[model samples]
Target chain A: MTERISFRSAQKKALDIARTRLLVGGALLAAAFLVIGVRLVDVTLFSENGPSRQANARNIAVEKKMDRADIVDRNGILLATGLKTASLYGDPSIIIDPKVAARALVGVLPELSEADVLQKLSSKGEFVWLKRHITPRQKYEVNRLGIPGFEFDEEERRVYPLGRLAVHAIGFTGDDNKGLAGIENSFNTALSERSERVTLSIDVRVQQILRRELAAQIKKFKALGGSGVILDVHTGEVLSLVSLPDFDPHTIKQASRSEKLKEEFKNQQFNRTTLGVYELGSVFKIFNHAIALETGVANMASNYDARKPIRSHGFTISDFHAENRWLTVPEIFMHSSNIGSAKMALDIGVAAQRKFLTDLGLMRRSSIELSEQQQAIFPAPWTELSAMTIAYGHGIAVTPLHAAAAVAAVINGGILYPTTLIRRDELPANGKRVISAQTSADMRKLLRLVVENGTGRNAEAPGYLVGGKTGTAEKPTAGGYKRKALISSFIGAFPMNAPRYVVMAQLDEPKGIKESYGYATGGWTAAPVVSQVISQAAPLLGIAPVDETAPNARRASAIKVATPRARGQGIATN
Target chain B: MKRPATLIIFGLAVFAGAMLFGVAFEVSNLEDRLTGLNKEITRDRDAIHVLRAEWSYLNQPERLDGLSQRHLELRPLEGRQFSDIAALPMRPNRVPTPTTDPVSAETAPAIAALVNAEPGGLPSAETPIATALTAKPKLKPAAPRRPARNVRLASQRISPEATTSTAASDKAALDAALRAIFGNTASNREGASR
Candidate 1:
């Protein structure tokens, strides 16, 4: 029995050896499978960038975000820019002492609420915000705190240092680092994503001068609002734009202010030269005469019956200080006779008139680059009454930018181009044609007649050959049009013989000034202001004085058709 | 056996050669990478220099003044001792061109040529046109009836028609004399300011 038991023990030992070998082989096989799986993951996630070789690869450190490109002027003036800023926050989960961190934080940022800070610090959140848009100084102070849980998250913030200057064109950004208003808002994608700098045509100095002059006028007149615009007609570039009762964009405390921000935008929503719509009084008459001449319905000596007020639908169309006689086209423009302009528009025909305005970019929203833009308010049905009122600068509203573009067409040899704020290479110099060259010349002569003798007399700037029109429209009140409250504006293009630039200045509810002899009319106010600005800026603009007296102006003037009575008188005299 | 041992030594030498080849390949790659980094640095430095120079050029205040001078006939600033804004006389109603018609502008009296080389009547289109080409009537800022050739529209608001609308002829006479002293415009206002 002993011999048999010993033999069984030996067999058990042999079986135990086989069991150990199987276990070791299985373990090795499992290790090989695990290695194959990891290698597969490595190939899928990263070839050279995988953890297997990541330590050897280059550019493996922190990535530097190439943030938003800056918007600068042609001369590299910073109109808009983004700066890298650090946002301070805390990991509440790691913060050991809530009271200690709160006390330390409040010391650096007095604006922060200590109770709120402590509450945030004591929260169970993995992350909590401490301060946003922290300046370098505040960052330095926070760094000095050296609190264990405190940290910084890199961020970018847009700041306008000039504040309110060119605010409409430059625009403002929203909280999430996006543009919400102006050029900033409109071109947000280009600015934030693109690496190339976006250059604008604004001359900061010119902008300052325009804003300064407009502001002084606003203050002097004690008006509710004011706007001014200057254009480089040849290039279709806006030199300066102004709208007042401005705001400091650096610090805005209220969200309500942000929505009403357009109102306080100085020239924000009021791109009077490009966006606001108003029946700009007599300024529209320039278009009327041009339309008549271009359509061959009127000549330089054509007569219009404006001897008395034409009372139609309670809109008495008459000239102030009435001539009470049949007036020539030049004389009519000089006198700013609505009755005469209505006649010119009628002769041009409604279809041709609408075509001309549309061609001139007056019947639609302007194509400028700014976000704040509006369509011109025109008669939907476009009735005969609409045509008449539109001819005399009534029954329509348009932005200043639109008017500027149209004015460019009037004096710029009837070439019209949409305004541009962005600086670009190779602009289309010859804009779309809105009228015949001969008609444009006739319009200029008519404009000169107005500045020389009519209501725009104040607009004459010696050698500048300045020609313009003045408009004073009573503001529409809640009940009816306010007889006293008015919107007075002057639009002028200098060196009218071959126009170079268009300048328009407007005063909203301008009070009668002692210097202006207590007259709030456009001639007494807006016209003179624009005339002065033009006269001062002309030589700077490099506009050489042409010898207007050089016998060319008479030749350029259309052949004056004589009246039958005048011809008969000449014959009789002969 | 000794031959087999010698064969083993040669195999060891081949293994060592392969290792050296791998090391050389790594060193060459590192050299290429270093060169690329150096090139990047150089390019960044050049960009910085160009941007700096452009910034300096743009910041030059003379650029604005130059542009302004090109666009406007801005007078050089003078010590108010010589000219005061408050002391200006009330402008005339219509300051049209005193010489409105080119016929009148051309009717200017012929003057003796200043330089022997210049043919004096009206400058030809080829010649550089200057207000100096026309003889100045006065050499002062405040003057009356300056020479028609040199007289531009005065910063004076009075249009030519308004020149006759003055309340007093005596003030006009005094203005005429002051213009005579500064009116020449031959002297560079920019130089004087500088």
Candidate 2:
């Protein structure tokens, strides 16, 4: 009986142990399944709402790829672009036979010398450059040579497709594809980011026309050089800006090594349109007349005595083409009379003249997209003689760009807009009003009178109603003005009934030609260029030509001159 | 019943896991294909960019001007050649006035008659267009009258049955008309060579 009782207790203890083991194992398995199920749900459902870490990493890799943006003209014509090219390189250490490799390379690239290639291939370096920016045909030929050590590196090179055309404006880049000049330098950051393409306000067609015409005149007159700027008066967009002796941007790297060629290249790179400042001659008369009319210091009927050369503080002021008599305001501007202009400036006073120039954006560095710009040279003390000479465009020197902009302000209904190379969606709202509308109209009429019967008669386009001023200033020397060297320039606006554009052409140190009747004056040299440009570019710009014989056009352009008391006075000579 | 139910749940879970894995594999394959296509697109874009730059370089205005002067007969348009729609002569009232020489016989006589009828000139009466056309008497006498006869003769000689004699004359007339339209081809070629 005792043994039976012991066996029963043992069995009960064993059964208890088994139940505890099973219960523990079952709980562990259930906990493991719960953890995995929660994890799977989290991964499949919540994870879809956000990007995985790997995807984020791939996106970063994509963003790191760098490319430069393209530059195009206003008409969507490609001006400058980056092209992919393969550069040839070699692993000299891997080359089996340096002489054979060099021979093969020289065969493919005739420009590369055999000695240079052999030296490079035999160098004790791991790698060396055979050539940079090899053409695809050459690259293929080199690859087909079955040379094991040779390799190609994919690279980008900036190319200006228009060659020498507008080279100064659409600048070139260095070997590393970094912009070193022009629009390239100014907008370097935007280009490297490859965010969007850059579109300039330049019309390639207009640029071609302006360059061809200006180059022809520069050759005809035998001038040292020339520069031209065409500005939209309403918007201040530089339609065409040209400087002569421009170099081709594409092959600038391979140019001849002669010192003279290098110096010529440097000179060609100097942008005269915005960088060079000159006394701009009588183009300032347009500003003077506008200021006189705007300030109410002179009117259509107001008269000044130009009967004799005015001597102010030992400085003699006269006109190149003098109408030596008491001259009305219209006659003063029409004849570009220096004595009349000085007397008128004296009436307007020095402070007012300075203020007028300052307001016209001539006293400061004009704002443009180009990094190459110089401030205007003006008299520091604002003396009486300074005011007198400045009246007829001396004592104050400005860039062709500045002169063009100021002329635009005078004829573009008196608002002064900052010049720009980039196209604008809307006209800038910050333009300051410099003159009254009525004064602008009266000034237009006087300008038209000058083009019609005065010194600017050569500037008239037969049916375009062209109105302008001619300026011929002797270049200043150390002691006095040079009698032979002259800067002849013409500033003109077309369809004077309502002005839309301002064109300025300047010739530097033009010599007299036989056809010019031995006179290298603006009327003979620069005025005809303006007429040709307007005649050709008008139809291109969609400006219709007006009928000059029509009664309305005749009446509209007629100038009323009030005769003065000193009409029969003696002639003034410089 | 409890054991069978547990076994059935396990089987369903295995089936679901297999489906999930299959879908994931398919998605990964498509993603790979998309990546390859993207790379191809990038390469094509780069190629197109290069081609466009080359095209622009080849089509530069200076180069095109030289090439056209060599191969084509064309001249730069002049401002005087442009006229307003109002300046165009009114189409004759009657369409049946067809004549052998359309340009010279019909139009020139009508223009001359109009100029004569009104002492002040055409009905537009002192339009600049009339003044410009009249001012260039040298151009009017030669340009308007000669091209008309040449064009008529060239068109009438298009028949295939023409003998060699007539064919030669036809060819000469056609050549003259082409020269007049384009410019002096011989002179252009010479200028290009120089």
Candidate 3:
């Protein structure tokens, strides 16, 4: 009986131990499941950022991307684009036979030297470049050779499809696709970072016309070189900018390889329209006449004695075609009388002349986007002699672009808008007002008078009513001006009543042709080019031609001038 | 009862596992399609990039200028060629008595019918149209109607013999008229301007 009781107690003790273990295991499992459930809820509904969001963020990285943005003209014609190309590279360590591989490569790419390729392939280095960019057909031909070490590194090459058309504007890229010059250098960061295209203010058709006409004139006159710019007078957008003797952007790569091409490349890279500064002679009279009218020192009826040349400080200021008599303001501008302009400048004083030119944005470096720009060379002390010479555009020198911008300000109601190469949706409201609207109108009348009966008669586009000034500056040398080498330039605006465009053409050292009556002056050379350009570009720009025979058309460009001969004799030459 | 409940739970677990595997496979298949589509898009984009570059090369102004000079009779427009719609002279009230030229002889009956079929039978002297036409004594016979009629007839019928001969004649006449009006075949334009 005692044994049976002991056995029952042992069975109960064993059951009790098993039950305690079961409870401990159940508690542990419940805690683990609760932790997992809480974590799931936090991740799905409560966590601010999660792995799922990170995965989605990664998906966005797979969208289309460009190495560099395209450069287009105002009409969306592609000026510069990035084309996909494969660069040939090799793993020299893996190349079984360097000579055989190099020979095969030279067979496909005739441009590559076999010895050079072999040397590169035989190097101990793990990687070497066989070539930078290869044609697709060459890539295929190389692949067919089944060379072990050969591999293609994908890259994009910058190409200008229009060749040398606008090389000075669009610029070119280097081997690594970095912009080297022109707008490429100016807007490098923006181009590489953004996928959107850069739209320039240039009209390719207008550019073509300007280039063709400038080139033809340069060839005909046997000039050294030429540059031209056509700007929207009101908006300050450059429609066309052409610098002659320009090189194709594609040749830049080859230029580095050959010494002859290097010399040619350096010569062609000089952008004359923006970089080279010259004492643009009579063109400055546009500013002088404008200044005289605006300061109220001279009017259309105002007269100065131009009977004899003014000899001041060992310098004689005389007219190119002297009308040796008392001259009114209109007569001085029309005949380009340097003596009359000097006397007028003397009356206005030096301070006013400097202030007026500064106000016209001609005293400083241009605010254009090009990195190739020059500061205007002006007299530092600005003496009386300087004022007189500057009045006829001698003491001060500026670029053709500066002259263009200043002329635009003069004809565009005396407001100077900052010039730009990028297209603008609206005229900038921050334009500085240099002269009164009345003064601007008076200047237009003077410009028209010059084109009508004076030296700029060659600038007439007939019904288009072109009005401009002729500037024939003797190229300045180290000690004095060279008489034979002249910068013959014409700065003109068409439809004089409401001028829309400012066209400036300049020929460097143009020799006289028989057709020009042995005259290489602005009136003989540059004026005809301007007239042709205006006539051809007017219809393209949607400018309607007015019948000059119509009474209203006659009234639009007409200015009344008092006869200088009737005014009287000389007021005594200084 | 416990046995049957355990059996039901086991069966439900098997169904849920199968559903999980099926959904995972479907997701994988969709991901594969997405990858393929992305690849195709990239290839097509590259092709478009190449084609755009080629197009720009082909459309160079210098090349186009050369091509036009060789293949086309068109020339740059002159200022005198443009005039306001109001400046154009009014249409002539009376058509020129059709010439008995071979092409015109074939269409003379059609033109007579067209002129006679006018709603106002005689076109009186006092009518505004007649007055407008009479204002310009140098107005030429505007023969625009005949070519338009020929185009309409050429499209509507398919008879091989008679229609083919007339169509050929009509085409030649149309070409001459078009060359005179719009095509800058200089000779034709010079005659018309004179």
- Which one wins on lDDT? 3
In order, the TM-score of chain B in each prediction is: 0.30, 0.46, 0.49
Best by TM-score: 3
lDDT of 3 at B20: 89
The weakest ten consecutive residues by lDDT in model 2 chain A span A57-66
DockQ of 1: 0.04
Q: Which stretches of candidate 2 lie over 4 Å from their true place?
A: A1-66, A90-107, A113-129, A145-149, A312-314, A562-574, B1-32, B67-194
Q: Compute DockQ for each candidate against the true complex.
A: 0.04, 0.18, 0.16
Q: In candidate 1, which residue ranges exceed 4 Å CA deviation? A: A1-65, A253-271, A546-574, B1-194
Of 1 and 2, the candidate ranking higher by lDDT: 2
Q: CA shift at A323, candidate 3, in angstroms? A: 2.3
Clash count in backbone of candidate 1: 50
Q: Candidate 1 residues A1-574, lDDT tens each?
A: 7788888888889899989999999999999999998988788765754644543344332223346667776567776666667898899988889999899899889999999999999889789988888987999989898888899987777766556677777867776778877678778888888756788888776676667667777788887777888888777888877776555555544435565654455443455545566668888888887888888898887777765677777677777656666667777777788888887887887799899888888877677887677788887888777888888887788776787778888777778876888875786755888887777877777777677767988877765677788888777657557877878888988777667788888888999989988888788778877877776666556664433343433333233433223332222221
TM-score of chain A of 2: 0.89
What tens digits encode model 3's per-residue C-alpha lDDT throughout B1-194?
Answer: 89999999999999999998999999889778867877777788888888888898898888888899999987775555553322222333333345533324334334433433332334233323222222222322442222222222322222243234533443444344333334435543454687
C-alpha positional error of residue A15 in candidate 1 after TM-score superposition, expressed in Å: 35
lDDT of 1 at A288: 83
Which candidate number has the best DockQ?
A: 2
Fnat for candidate 1 (0 to 1): 0.00
